[model samples]
Target: MSAHDFNPLLDIPVFPASGFAPLADRLKRIFATGNDLLFIQAEALLALEAAASSLGRPGLVAVNVVTSPYGTYFGAWLRRAGADVVDVVAPSGQPVATEAVAQAIEMLGHVDLVAIVHAEAANGALNPLEEVAALARAAGALLVVDAVASAGGHAVDIEGLGIDIAVLGPQKALGGPVGLSLVTVSDRAWAAMQSVPRFSPSLLSLLDIKEAWLDRGRGALPGTPPPLEFHALAAAVDRLEAEGLAARITRHQRAAKASRAGLRALGVEPWVADDDRASALVTAAPVPDGVDASALIDAAAAFGVALGRGFGDIEHRLVRLDHTGGRAAFGPVLANVTAYGAALAALGQVVDIGAGAAAVTAVYGEA
Candidate 1:
């Protein structure tokens, strides 16, 4: 294909800022939320930081559940904002227990906010968001969840879960650009943010976006919106609507199940053994004894299959077999499982590659 023939692909169109509010409305429907939603032209982490900065202030006590690095960052942002944060940290590759969250809330007596990450994609842990949300609501605390990796892969009902502030990045499961993100805010959260007089109006200020864009009729966005990111987001929503959100979620679940089953057959246990606690986006397993994670990943790459490295403290200890976005399909799942087995064998570890492939095939066949 010559550049002349592909000119249409390169020719980009302008994404009008006026269309931002409507897109937000469409996203609200996707999330099934009646609460106010905002589209920030940045990754979900920045939006999450904004939430912590906006909600965290002097006199606000928060119970931050640390399941992954994102949760740790939330606590730091809250502390920087002057809030007294009690971090409930879970063991690596495990979800925070609901009982622990309850205990923290009870001990605090008055928690103004609760923060958590719904899914840590690379860590293989899916937090008990429903139970934790209930705890936060019972404590009369605003709950903020980083659902960047879980939104499309799993069922995320913002209003149903009573998530006071939920942040999402479309780059992961939604297969969209990483430059744009969205957040859902409840009435109570808005009120609490309004009460925080210490928060100044800035790009990361949720209140600033509300006062300037939403309150002012939701016309043009506050800053210059990136055209490519907005257009890609629109395309992603189109694809999502066409393929039913429930179906997309089911595909991810199947991918996870298939990966786990295949890995188990090859004697590689899942990082999180419980299916209920593991993330659907990726399946994580510890690197074999004396096996270098980077070398295994490189070997898998040689076989034309991409494997991800774990993040944070578990970076060198674990390897992630991604089944996210476009890869949540039979072909990719099978390739990932078989390639991983092959890489282990190449590294002198005994593995049943044929058994692993058969296991993956059986999963799809049953489906």
Candidate 2:
């Protein structure tokens, strides 16, 4: 193919650089945040690391809640930036309890920041963000939340919850590209970050972003921007606006309920026993004894069904069923549950596939 062959996809017009700020504004609307919003030209993890670098320093005490690997990474970043971190870790396949957070805060005497993941997509758990946020508020600690997996699938009222910093990845529940990430900074967070000198004029510098893009009247980004990602993000936001945020969240909730019901009918209890503590993005079940998790996942794939394995230590102990973004629908949820049942049956486990399918359909019907 010649360079000038006029391929509609490759020959598209460039994404105007002037639209960057307006794009950030659109994302801010989705988050319902009144604080300053910035778009990072990389994945959400980079934005998270940048936030940690900008806020962490010597003499700062941070309470980092660990339910997933993302939380662990955030804590590590804070530590690398010279903050004294108090890790509040939860058990496998569960969210951190609010009481544990309270205990950590109480033991610390004073906390400069409280960091948490709103949802653990890796293991299908939902943290008690509202309760934790209230505790942080009482302790006069700035709240930092990783809402990459929970923003669209769950309610995340940044301003209402008093979140000083929020990191969002639109690729997960927003059905967007992964090449860009969004960050929201509250006034309190900005003030705190101004005191940190660890972040220099690097690509991961939030201060540089504030000075270049934010303070300069909000126009084009400072460095060269990836047009493809910007355009894709705009398209994803358009879809979210068309569907309505509340309705999108309802769809994910219904999918989770149906998935849990189907799994229960198959005699497979969800990893998170409590419904309220389970994430709407994914449903995970413990691998039955004597069944090879890899074999079962392969069997599901042979049946043209795509299933996921748990991350980190739980990779071999549990199976993950994704019901996020486009897959948060009756067809995909039922297909996932049915595939798991079939995989079990293929692996010599006695399961009532008929009952499981019925349970899934019934839940959807009720919805």
Candidate 3:
């Protein structure tokens, strides 16, 4: 490869400012939202921070749902911006009860913003978004969601759910690049952002993202567009559509069900007790007696069993087995169960690896 040679593999086409809105249109289809969408140059974390920070000026009261560490991050950002944040904290790895969220909303008097994570992929805790969204609707609060881990694998209809601002990352189950954050902003959210003077133009400004794109004919992108990542995003969207989102979601659900059943055969149980309440993309569990989750994670790695670190406070206490995006298949489900059983055995815990694998196979076969 000569220095002057334009390697198509390494050198991608420059993503034009005009190309952004069209790509965002495709991304909006992921959540089935008619709201205005913005492609953030950074990860969903930064996109969320920008939205929450700008929405959290003085006199703002927010009812923040705390089911995972992501929620904690949002609450902190809102507080820093002088918002009185009411955190409805649920136990780590467990779904947030809808009742608690309603109670929080009632107690808050007037909530200006409502923030929640749709799913905690780190520890497999899924929140009750529909009910919470209803509460936010009744309160007339701007609802913000970090749907990074759930958008692809889970059913997310931002319009139907009345989400004011939804931050999504396709890297999780959408199999897209990790560098971009696809954000859908509602008219209500834009109005709220406009009221804050501190919401000025910057990398951490959601208004800047909207204005940069919509203010002047699909306005200029803030920095040099990340061409490769944009290409990766497009490719991922194409692949997902080819497979069909319904089929993709079904695959993750089957993988999760298989993982839970197989783990039971191995004398292990799910971290979140209710199967329906947990995330379909990840199967998290407590490390059995005589074994540490961190140690098991490392041991599993030796056999190429890559897993997600537990989210929030359960990082060291729990373990996550992923069945997301490209890995949400029968083959990956079987491999995950076998590796988990093998790791348990290595930790001096007697588990039926064969039986566990068979269970996984049976579950996937049923699906």
User: lDDT of all predictions, in order shown?
Assistant: 0.90, 0.91, 0.84
- Per-residue CA lDDT of model 2 for 139-230, tens digit only, reads 99999999999989999999999999999899988989998998899999999987888445787788889999889988888888888888
Ranking by TM-score: 2, 1, 3
State the lDDT at 191 in candidate 1: 90
Better of 1 and 3 by TM-score: 1
- What TM-score quantifies how close candidate 3 is to the native fold? 0.95
The segments of candidate 3 whose C-alpha lies over 4 angstroms from its true place after superposition are 1-10
Instruction: Give the winner by lDDT.
Output: 2
Clashing pairs in 3: none
Off by over 4 Å in 1: 1-11
Mind giving the per-residue lDDT tens digits that candidate 3 earns over 15-119? 766777677777777557889888888888898898887688888999998887788889999899888999999976788999999998888788888898887
Model 3 scores what on Cα lDDT? 0.84
RMSD of each: 2.0, 1.2, 1.6
User: How many steric clashes between backbone atoms does each model show?
Assistant: 0, 0, 0
The lDDT ranking, best first, is 2, 1, 3
Give the C-alpha miss distance for residue 313 in model 1, angstroms.
Answer: 1.3
TM-score of each: 0.96, 0.98, 0.95
Q: What would the per-residue lDDT of candidate 1 be over residues 94-194, giving only the tens digit for each residue?
A: 89999999999999899888899998885989999999989988998898999999999999888888898989999989989999998889999999987
Model 3 RMSD to the real structure? Answer: 1.6
